[model samples]
Target chain A: MPSIECREIYFSYRRSDPVLKGVSLSASPGEMLGIVGPNGAGKSTLIRIMAGLLKPQNGSVLLEGLMLHGLASDDRARRIAYVPQDYHLVFPFTVMDVVLSGRYAHGALKIFETREDRVIAGRVLKWTGLENLADRKFEDLSGGERQRAVLAAALAQEPELMLLDEPTSSLDVNHADNLMALLDRLCSDQGLTVIMAVHDLSLASAWCNRLGFLDQGRMNALGEPARVLSFDRLKSVYGDSVKRLDLDGRIVIAPRGKRNTNA
Target chain B: MLDMDKTRRKLVLACILGGLWLLACGLSGLLIGSTSIDIVRALNGSGPDAQILLVARLPRVLLAALTGGALASAGVGFQALLRNPLATPFTLGVSSGASLGAASAILLGLDTALLGSAAVPLFALAGAGLAVAVVYMLARRRGSLLSTNTLLLAGVCLAFFFGAVMLFLHYLADFGNSYRMIRWLMGSLDITDIMVPLKVFVLTIIGFILLYSNSRRLNVMSAGEEVAQSRGIDVDKVQRRIYFSGSLLTASVVAATGPIGFVGLVVPHVVRMFTGPDHRVLLPASFFAGAGFLILCDLLARVLIAPTEIPVGVITAILGGPFLVWLLRRQVEN
Candidate 1:
């Protein structure tokens, strides 16, 4: 069975309108699944539901054959770690302090971090290339560095599956590529399941083993990257003005210019 | 290793210095009340000095420390729960409610001998509890107490409403009663019997322990509610626990001593600057520092005008206001 599965999940913030409607996807261990969608397509809401932060009004999420909602919060955290899109720090906590907080689920109640907890946090920091910034204030880090710091914190949870919501939305090209490569390596080397929502279709096609395209709170397509990222599917979901090109073994989607449209 | 050692050293120094300061201030408060006492005679437990020391001064000083510590700890709890540096007992209208209760008691001429000395404090505690219940009821959305903005707005409105009621009571009271009511509203550290402070001490100690045990969870919460939940914290549960405990802590303190301001708002910020936002360290440190700070303020209130005692709350604001401004400026500069 897939390590993580969502069966016909449905959710809504209000009674009148739904944010997610009958969306179902699954991810096996040692694989990366990328979700691509336009704005307001319920990418964030879906990820939150998978992470157990939000409960779907209908259907269910299962982790390792157990109901995600049935598991206690700490138990769910032990199995799945979630990285949010933005983090706001109100006080000056060191980067180490921020990362060490990830071990909160593992520690005994009312107890502080232990020696083993420090070792794990340090390892994750080094893996994420944040060891040099350990003592620096979390608020002082750059955007890309902050994103990586948050990723490192998620890694410290030692979770079997990791859920990231638009993890690269704020990063520059180089940092974005570096983060994707790191995630790919962690998936292969550690046998971890990674499910992330990405805005960059090219990056999603290049790194993800499979892609799920969402349009208006419904799954429009789900398959291998090439099948899901087809020109006709892209044009239909995104609009008729969308076009794609295959370059360097990556599918790149772009808006059709006036000259190209006329031709 | 060196960094850890430096941190340990700093913590030890703060504890030692804070303990000594509390001791000095407590002694000074005992010795320098409205009337001077012979220290040796008072310590010997004989003479008029003994009567004043045992009956009045000692209980007042202890109450000041306990109330100060309770308010400060509750301040830290509120700030963490609301994720706002400015949150305090006053921000939640608990103190205002207590103030209204005390004023009403005084205006109505409630007999202390019949109701016991705790009549006013009990009334104040009930008012504070009612205010919190109203704020909670207003802020809750679909059975979840997750909205900090709604809570803040409701608390502020309740405060204004309670303030208007107190003013109307003052306007109706006779001149002698109005003067007494106003003085009580200004905040005092007066204690007639030792039992009140002893009871408050026990209650506040239990409150502080509960708050301390949840410090780790609070540390995670300071990041944000969603982030806290992702890390396995039950945000709603923590919010409810902290809110009720913090409000009760404030109520107990405000009930005994009329709403002593500034200590709750200022002491936590000062302690945060030194402790760097870890609640396990911050909460305890705030309690100690707050205890010392209020005792010192009480000492100043006693000595500033000699025979005519200034209100302790006035002294706390006058002293804490400029200091907080300076601290904020320094934080910005750094």
Candidate 2:
């Protein structure tokens, strides 16, 4: 059974303009679904509705056949963790303290982290390769390291589902590749369902099993990567000419036709 | 486990700082007045000047400490709740609301005696509450909380409005009452006894404890509203509680001491720089540091011009304005 199902979700920030226009999608457990869209396409909004951060005006979101919108915030947090792209650490919070906050939904009144929670947070940090940086100030870390810390915090929730919005936007090429690979492992090894809104169509093609293309607050298409990553659909949705090439068993999307040589 | 150790260490250090502050301020407050009463003789309650020292200087020092601590702690909560580093009690219209309340009461012939002291504080509290409610309402419209920048702008505008109202009242007041209103506007620690400010002090302690008890919640809140909500925190409820409680503390103190400046803004940031962002540490540290900081400032206010005591606000502005500028330069340099 799918871990999440959204039915005709409609959302709008302003009354006249809709952000998500009846967008509906579903993801099975352990599946990595990548939502690829251009700017202002409501990719993040759809993810937020799925993660129960924002309520849909007309549609319902269900987790395991249970309506997610009706559940309490802690219940949703216990089952899923959402990591947004921009994480600005305004204070001198330690890496461990920030990660330990992931366990907050489990124990609300426990101000100090329990030993068990600490062990879990530490394990997750180690998995995310941030164990050595546990004591360092979060703001003091490099951009890639900070993104890893964010991943560690999300992983510490022990969630069956993870939602990420542009997890690689702030990272360099190597860091982005490493992070996507790590997420892929988590999905396969732990049967964790992952849904991420990504801008880089190439990364999505490489890492995601399934793809959902959003355009103008609507899901234009949803299917396997090969089926959704076709040249025609890619060009239509993104308006940038994407060249799909088969390099052995892997598929890569290159900007073949859109490059302007006159510059 | 390490966090616990750090929390304990912070508590101990804050306590030490507070104790040293109180002791130094107490002695200075008692000894630096017109007569230069001896601290040892005052404490022993044996000198011919003992009654004057115990009754006058003792209450003044305690009031100054309490008012300072209250305003500073309120500052910390305001900053956290608003998620703006520039937030403070005075800037948020809390002091203006309180001052308006106090000034209104005084205009109605309540200033000649202590007959309406409790009433003045109550009205001041109400004024603060109303101003906060207005700010909250303005920041939150049509069901969503407003952004931090908008909230700050609204608070400043409301503060200015209240200040204008207060000025209008000042102009309409009689000659004798006008002089009293002008003095009160300058801010004084001239309460005859410790009871009124002591009540405010107790409220400050209670309010600060409530704020500190939820320090962990505050830590998560500092991340962002969506993150805090996604983490199971009732962000709206917590924000409302913080706003109400912080405003209560701010209004009460402003009423008690006629709006002393800069302690709330300066103390919290200084405390955060040294103690880090954990509210458990920040709250208590701000409390003690604020109390100590204000008392020391008050001591300067009295002795800087021995024969004619400058308003405590003047002392704080002179000290705090320069210190803040230096801090800003340091932040930029770092």
Candidate 3:
């Protein structure tokens, strides 16, 4: 059975046009699924829906053959963890504090942090290679370090499935590659299912086992990268001013010359 | 785990220190009223000192402590709920609403004609409830999403509206009632009957517990609402509880103290610098520290320029004003 499945999902903000229309997808263990799309193509919204953070106006989400929305939030969080794109980091909470916050599901009624929770958080921090920076305040970290810290916090949830929204938006090239590699390793090694909304098509194509191309609130393509990201498909969705090149057995798309001017 | 234990020890030690400081402040308040007194002789000997200490100063100190603790606790919750550090006990304009209620009650002759002195606090509480209800309704948007902007704007509008009503009432009152209303507005903890304030303080403590139970969720929320919701929190439910508790705590304290300022806005921030952002530690520690701070302020109000007392509100403002400037500048430099 699939770990998470969404059938005919539809969502819209109040009184506005639909942001998602009849979106259906599913993921199983030991796989990395990437949703790649232009800005405002309902990528983040879909991830939020899958995380059980939003109620779809229509359709349903199922996790491990059970209804997603039926379970309590803490129950859902135990199975699926979400890493948000934009963190509001208002206070100077330590990295340790940030990771320990994920243990709320483990101890909702307990006020103080327990030894078991500390051990788990420490293990996650070490796994994410952030053990050295555990004492540092969140605001004091570099961009890559902060991203890793948030990832570590989500890992503390001990989830079977992880959903990330634009996890590499704040990282440099090396950090982005490093993070994708780490996620890739985690998925295959631990039988973890990772579904991420990625803006970088090249990274998505290279790392993800399956890629879903979203355009104008609809899933245009979903399959292996070579099948889903055909040259003609890229031109049709992204317009005529793009070029696709096969570089060392990898499909790389680059913006060619000036922007498309006339209709 | 050793560090975890160390952290707990630090938190416990801090709370103990805060409790001790509050105790010291209470003792000092007894000693430093209008006239200094040696306590052992006063309690032992049949003198006016015993009456002065127990009847007059003790209740005053307790009330001051209650007011301060309640305001600071509410402030901490509101700040975390709204995710804005600038939030205070009065941020939602409940204090102005209470003030209006008290002012109108005084002017309407409710103090003498109907429920006697009890009527004023009753009316003020009603006004506070009205203000909270209106703001709560106005801020609500699209299925459980409470708009922070709307809450703030509605609060500001209510504050202005209530302030105008208060001024009109103040303008129309006769001189004797006018003096009474004015004194209540300036905030005095000097009440012969401490029963009403004590009950409100008890209610406020209950509210603090509700906030404390959600302190972990609040720690996650400080990262962002989305972050909190993603981490298994029922964001809407938690937000509603925190907002309700914060409003109740602030309203109860304002009704008792006639709108004490500075303690709400400054105390939580001051306590946070020491406690860091852990709401579990921050909540109780701020309560005690705030109590001590207000006791010190109330003592100064009494001791400075003896025989004639400065309004406690005036003392808070005079002291709080410069402290706010320093805080603002420091915030910018950081």
Candidate lDDT (C-alpha), each: 0.87, 0.83, 0.86
Off by over 4 Å in 1: A255-263, B1-14, B33-36, B111-116
What is the per-residue lDDT of model 1 for residues A1-94, given as tens digits with 9 covering 90 to 100? 8999999999999765998889999999999999998899999999999999889999999999999999888888888999999998777888
Ranking by TM-score: 3, 1, 2
Candidate that would win on DockQ: 3
Better of 1 and 2 by lDDT: 1
Top TM-score: which candidate number?
3
Comparing 2 and 3 on TM-score, the stronger one: 3
lDDT of 2 by residue, A1-263 (tens): 78999899889986669898888899998899999988999999888888788888898988989999888888888998999878875667999878987888888877666778878987998899988999899988999999999889888889989999999998888999999999999999999999999988888988998999999998888998888878788778656555678888678877755344333
User: How much does candidate 3 score in TM-score?
Assistant: 0.96
TM-scores, all candidates, are 0.95, 0.94, 0.96
Clashing pairs for model 1 are: none
The TM-scores that each candidate's chain B achieves against the reference are 0.92, 0.91, 0.93
Point out the higher-scoring one by lDDT: 2 or 3.
3
For candidate 3, the docking band is: medium
What value does the interface RMSD of model 1 take? 1.9
Give a tens-digit lDDT track for model 2, residues B1-334. Answer: 5655666677788778877866776766767766666667777876667876878677888888888888888898888888878778777788788778887887887655544456666767778888888887888756665556667888899989998998899899888777766777778887667687668777887777777767888888888888887777877778777877787778778878788888999999888888888887788788878887887887787777777888998888899989988987998899
- Which fraction of the native contacts appears in each prediction? 0.53, 0.56, 0.71
Candidate 3 chain B weakest lDDT stretch, 10 residues: B112-121
Which of 1 and 2 is the better model by TM-score? 1
